[model samples]
Target chain A: MARIDLVDLAHSYDGGNADPSSFALKPTSMTWRQGGAYALLGPSGCGKTTLLNIISGIVKPSRGKVLFDGRDVMALTTQQRNIAQVFQFPVIYDTMTVGENLAFPLKNRGVGRAEIDARVHEIAKLLDLVPQLDRKASRLTADAKQKISLGRGLVRADVAAVLFDEPLTVIDPALKWELRSKLKVLHRALDLTMIYVTHDQTEALTFADTVVVMHEGSVVQTGTPEELFLRPDHTFVGYFIGSPGMNVLPAEVEGRQARIAGHELSLARSYGGLPPGARIEVGIRPEFVSLAAAAPGLLAARIERIDDLGRSRFAHVRVGDLKIAARVPRGLSLGGNEAGLIFEPAHIHVYADQRRVEGAA
Target chain B: MEKIPNQKAWLLVLPVFAIVAFSAVIPLMTVVNYSVQDTFGNNKFFWNGVGWYQELLDPSTELGGRFFASLWRNLAFSGAVLAIQIPLGIIVALAMPREGWGVAFSLVVLALPLLIPWNVVGTIWQIFGRSDIGLMGWGLNRLGFDYNYVANPIDAWLTIIIMDVWHWSSLVALLCYAGLKSIPEAYYQAASIDGASRWAVFTAIQLPKMRHVLVIAILLRFMDSFMIYTEPFVVTGGGPGNSTTFLSIELVKLALGQFDLGKAAAMSIVYMLIIIIVCWVFFTVMTNAGADRKGAGGER
Candidate 1:
């Protein structure tokens, strides 16, 4: 168990010899505390997995240093780093028995045969794979293969951290729930520093204790799941962390209020840096939007379409020139008439150039 | 289902099956016809009626002496190739990159030898193994070992073996490379987090993951090696007194040079049967492995 610190690590795939624009990951610093379950969540090509690989010593930073337990590992190989990583697709050996696959690391390290057997038995039992020890790994279903992948990753007792890069993506849809919960149990039982990378919001939110929201090669925010959902530090985090995402609208700020779609919404807090007519926007989660028949509140919106999302209904609405989503409780009688969009004033967030400007008042 | 009959699907398989079957059927039928009868110079035929089979077992037939010797040589050659290629190919595959520029570069370089024709590889090596022009021969001759592919049996065998390694190790390498490539990067991540050593990653993750491809590689290499004629023949002409004469080269000598059509036919049938049996053994091992993993029936 070790704490990983990435210090001002900037990685450039473009050789970094030409220009400053060649950098993929600009100099960024962050820390993952020991035993913390962190997920690097971002869209594809956003450098979430790249950052994780860099942390794991698969990709070294072109500048700065990566520290594990306060020791610089800039010149270390992945083997020297001793990081366990699970890829998006299952990577278990097909030829070996499931038992052998699980016990591989122990065997490789020259653990006693009896001890290896016990550890393999324990892990297989924990993974509900006790009955499959004798079976070759290739014939197992995709889920079982993935479980072996996880089991192999967890076999070693002295690993620095366990890094999962979209490990659940290849699992059958029905088995994703069970395997994810198994990983959580293994994490708790072992208390290893685990960093999972995924673009799936629900998986990131549910599986990780702390979510590190990354966008375009930089960490936008890292906080507990609730903190991420409730108060995102950046516009990307706001849009990325929520299902249907947060609704963002162009706005003009004056005094204590922000005007959006030709109407004003009260700001909970004021920012001294943002200019009056600057490129400003107000953001709120779709889940917080209250539907109305025909009245004025924050602004008026036209219900374009209603999407039934089981527990809630997302009314695809048009707020002036912008299309925004307002999630109402399932079976709300929303009409095509100008429906007033109401949100708690304290929940409103104002952004200037993709950075948060208005604080909660 | 009637509305969308899978005609397009068959379009994909038709070309491959056609090419494979057409190439296999004619020569096989000729071998079969020759196996059942004896032919003379004027095309006079006599019914042999399993005489060659009795001779094959009796060890008294003129066919058995040179034939069995080459058969043993072929088996030994296949064993030696397997002992060297699989582990070496896998190591090369592991050292290569999973993606990016390194991937394409490694692939192109590794694929170079596999693209050369069998005869060309033999010719290239034959020249390269010469004491005069080839560095290997020059170096060997410089050391006064008296290495010559044309005269010495051991040297011919060694040259053929080296030439075989050079020509075909790449196929195994490329196959294993493809296998290694197909492994999801997730496995490496899993291995890394497990605190597995690099060796553990290769043995547990890389080797196990490459089983199917390695099996295919082995089978293809085995069958190809078993049927090997062109390379060894071009290099040693099955000479240096039969040191490098494999089963196929012997079959060719019998059928083409000596005109022993009936014996050649019988041997070809026996050769085909041996190939079939070896292929079956590999198939059995692979299928059983696959079945044991599945936790159910072996049926596809």
Candidate 2:
């Protein structure tokens, strides 16, 4: 079992920057438990890759403490860190035989030749690369090359954690899904700590036990996939973790009612002490929103457009000047002019500034 | 759906092929004609079948042994240049920073020597090695030794080797530098995460990755050195007898100095054949190495 603790970590490509604007990753702290498949999920330039690189020792953080199993690894080189990283593009030696590339890391660690062969074949078999073991990497297809790269990382069982940095970006869609599932299964069987960095919510949700949602250069939210989807603490996580994203509309809140386009929605009876004049935002997952004919419901919105994505439907509704998207089940024709929208009080997340406020008072 | 027939594209390239053939084939035919004929002054000619080839291969002939010796020196010179240049090039490339002002700075400095023309490089070395006026020669002489390249064969050889190293070593370094630069930063990252030592990074990753460029650098240096003439000819004039008279210098001595075009043309063909054979061996070695990496990936 391996546990990693990162403390006060920040990085800037430029030597010294007193301001956060000059830094790529803001100062942050985190602890990852052993055998947990955690993912750093964010868009490009969100510092997920930078954080992964820092953890792997490829990138040295400007100010930080990186501890693997309670031992500080910040000053240690990448080799000393004892991590395995797979990059966006496959990086196997093109001249080396597949078997050779897989065997190399083992031999470098001074593993016996017989043991190296045994481990290489075992990992190759797991990755479905046994048939191509003798072929040159240059002659292999893109998918095969990436498998060799994956095998190289997996061949060594002693590493603290396996870090993946968008390793499936170059692979085809079918292979991508298969490979993602394979990683999940392998993590379960081996019980190794895995940190996968990806911008795709589906991959993060499926492959990671804990999804750390990052935006700009800061960690916005970190929880299980269900926790993130059902209760996003930050507006960025709300928008980033779901398809059709959660619809965030401006509102005026006073006491128990939140007014939107002159239509006020009552908060739960429990919330009674929200501070006044705070910039209030109402967030509701598209899947939770339902259209009703009644007027005393949550809010009033005009149906702007409807997008059909096979099994589910997305209705873009206009609430005053703001647009909110609601995910509707199949076989429902959303009318244009005036439609009542309702959400369970539990799913209606209220926010002050960008941070989530407690159940609306 | 009706099938679309494939059209011939070579018809579009016919004129380019004709022009290339007209220019190259005619000149090669002239050389081949000269290689098999005996011609004295006044354009007098007699049929000489395999005459020059036989004389050059014959050990008893004076000029024959000279041809073999010159060829040997040419081969040895190419080997020496490869042994020194390729590894030196890789070292310089590795030491060069990946990006920023340093890379730009190193690039400009490396480019400076390559910009000098071959003959101009020879002229500069020739002047720089003069005993009376040149810095290196005068400095060496002042240390109490005869260091005259014009008279001494050993001095001339050293000068030529140094001149070649200075003039062309930059090219090998630059090619290797490009190869090294093209390697993705991720490979180093992977090696680092693998806990690969510095020597392992160089041996397993850097050196193997530079194999393609290394082969190219060797081929370029070999071909160029095997046909080297201008620099050594301009610097030492193949002087102090035939010590520095490589195949190209000897060819010139036969065709221009003695006006024996028949013998010179025959030697030129033999020289071309040697280069082709050596280049073939190099290609074979590289292809086998590439082939050995088979089955590492999927269906090729």
Task: Find the candidate with the highest TM-score and give its number.
Answer: 2
Off by over 4 Å in 2: A269-277, A293-300, A329-338, B1-23, B131-133, B144-151, B284-300
lDDT of 2 by residue, B1-300 (tens): 998775676777888889888898778788888999989868888778899999998867876887988888888888888888877888888898888899889988988988998899999999999999999899999999899999999999889998898888888889998888777888887877766788988887888778888889999999999999999999988877888889999999999999899999899888888899989999899978766455444422
Q: Estimate each model's TM-score.
A: 0.81, 0.91
Off by over 4 Å in 1: A17-22, A109-122, A185-187, A268-273, A296-298, A308-310, A327-336, A358-361, B1-48, B61-70, B73-142, B146-152, B159-178, B192-199, B213-265, B291-300
- In terms of docking quality, model 2 is acceptable
Q: Write the per-residue lDDT of candidate 2 for residues A1-361, one digit (tens) a residue.
A: 5799999999887754567776889988999999999999999999999999899888888888899889988778887777888898888776578899898778878999889988898898888998989976667887888888888888888889989999888888999999999999889877789999999999999999899999999999999999999999999999998988998878877667777778777766334566676777878888988765426554777887778888777778887788888766556554446777777666888888878877623
TM-score of chain B of each: 0.87, 0.92
TM-score on 0 to 1 scale for chain A of candidate 1: 0.94
lDDT of 1 by residue, A225-315 (tens): 9998888888899998787888888878765777777787776687556765567888889888877676745477888887877777888
**Alpha carbon lDDT at B139, candidate 2:** 91
Deviation (Å) of A250 in candidate 1: 1.9
The two-chain DockQ for each candidate, comma-separated, is: 0.36, 0.44
lDDT of 1 at B40: 84
| Cand. 2 TM to true fold | 0.91
